[model samples]
Target: MQGITGYELSSRKAEYLKYIHMQGDVVKTTEIAANFSVAPSTATKTLAEIAKAGYIEHTPYHGVRLTPTGTAYARFLVRRHRIVALVLSHYGLEPDEACKEAKKIEPCVSKSLTDRICASLGHPMMSVCGEIEHDCCCCCPSGDHET
Candidate 1:
């Protein structure tokens, strides 16, 4: 978690990580290609880069799974998105609109900023999109901190 921040990945790569995280299991390269509307070879190349960065383990003829570092990073990505979208909703955007807009804005937001925003929002446990997960590395109250 120390080295894996939400800022280091490109929007596309981060999206792929988020997608894989959401899937909750190994995902085929072809499935990724289909999800992003890219060629399988393109997915492979990009995934290679991701794997090189230590975010995933890719096996030939099999699929990819997030490393522990990747899992933590992806979770942060999801938390960042939900918190930002919740803020957008509070600022008058509809729930769906806020969610869509968050996807566009999330890549620009940092973990520190997200943590501050989450703290300001009283450590909300739910967002318009889903339940929020807190990490003690950031906004959790001292009493609520978890290992």
Candidate 2:
């Protein structure tokens, strides 16, 4: 949790983090609000909570940036999102549709389950959107997160 959020992350908060990570640098507050279709004030409130958790550095007028820990967690979320999308595709959904559906399922998936999924997906290099990075559990021996 310390490496991820320092506490349990709400699925919505995770999505916000995902968006910030995709931005790849200091992300504008307006961009976050627009991406999530939420009001700027709403984005501000949510971001304030996430920033309080230490996942991002937020400045009132300057937007936000992911902390190193945030980047690590976002990678894991992205991996799960893509993998779940791939699974949805097997059910005849279009890649784009699958990606949408995956969003609903991704946050609930546990790390162990995600590993099983990644394996079954043959450790894919890319999903519909773009690249996928393996999390430590997926890369470590026997799927262990702890060294």
Candidate 3:
């Protein structure tokens, strides 16, 4: 059976997209490799596949940027993952465990399921991993938004 294109994103690709979205502008392959602790060639290969899927634009020797479709999808995934993490936290799991579980489950969940999870969890502003945050908390609690 053929998988639907939009929903066919791998966790690694989704994670890379999330990182780029958070960072904004184009992101270098070397930086992404460093962040994920992978070799640059591996990162390049992964990015090439994503670009072929029309989710990103890869410039040789420069970096990668998300296409409009990629931006929207990445944002949705990030939202789902964070909400799931928060809901898991309420279930007595430690934050780190919740984040791990969220990462594992996020890609398989439908948007409707994510919406329900977010609603049930009271719409959390911070992810259990603490890497993602809602607009209201764009910066660290004690840090300036511009810093």
Candidate 4:
């Protein structure tokens, strides 16, 4: 968290992180490729990049797993996307529509901005997509994201 600025990742890389996080376990390169509709070789190359960035540990024959730092980052990414979608819904977009719009908008949103929006929304507990996890370093006074 110390070194991450929330902007260091490209949208594609961030998407991969989110997917890996959602999996909650080791993910095969072929699985990723299939999900993203890319070639296995393409996923392998991208996974190599992600691994070099310290987000995932990829075993040649096994699969990829997020590192601790990667997990934290992915959590933040999820929080950002949910918060953005929630804000869009407030302005008349439906839940699903807002979620779609958020995918386009969230990558450009910074962590500081996300925290500001979260605070402005009174730190809502649940979002259209899922529960909102608040971190002490941002909007929440309590460090526990679960709360």
Per-residue lDDT for 7-124 in model 1, tens only? Answer: 8889999999999999888999999999999999999999999999888999966989999888888888898999999999999999999999999999999888888888888788
Report the C-alpha lDDT of model 4 over 1-147, residue by residue, as the tens digit.
Answer: 555567978999999999999988999988999999999999999999999999999998788999998898998999899999999999999999999999998989988888888878888878888888775245677653433
lDDT-superior candidate, 1 or 3:
1
Candidate 2, pairs of clashing residues: none
Q: List the global CA lDDT of all models.
A: 0.86, 0.79, 0.75, 0.87
**Local accuracy of candidate 2 as per-residue lDDT tens digits, 24-73:** 89998999999999999999999999999888999998999999878777
Total residue pair clashes for candidate 1: 0
Q: Taking the tens digit of each residue's C-alpha lDDT, what string does model 3 give over 36-145?
A: 99999999999999999887999979999999877777777677777778778888999899988888887787766665555555455566666443332222345322
lDDT of 3: 0.75
Q: Tell me the alpha-carbon RMSD of every candidate.
A: 2.5, 4.2, 7.4, 2.1
Query: Each candidate's TM vs. the true structure?
Result: 0.92, 0.85, 0.76, 0.92
Candidate 3, residue 117: lDDT: 58
Pairs that collide in candidate 1 are none
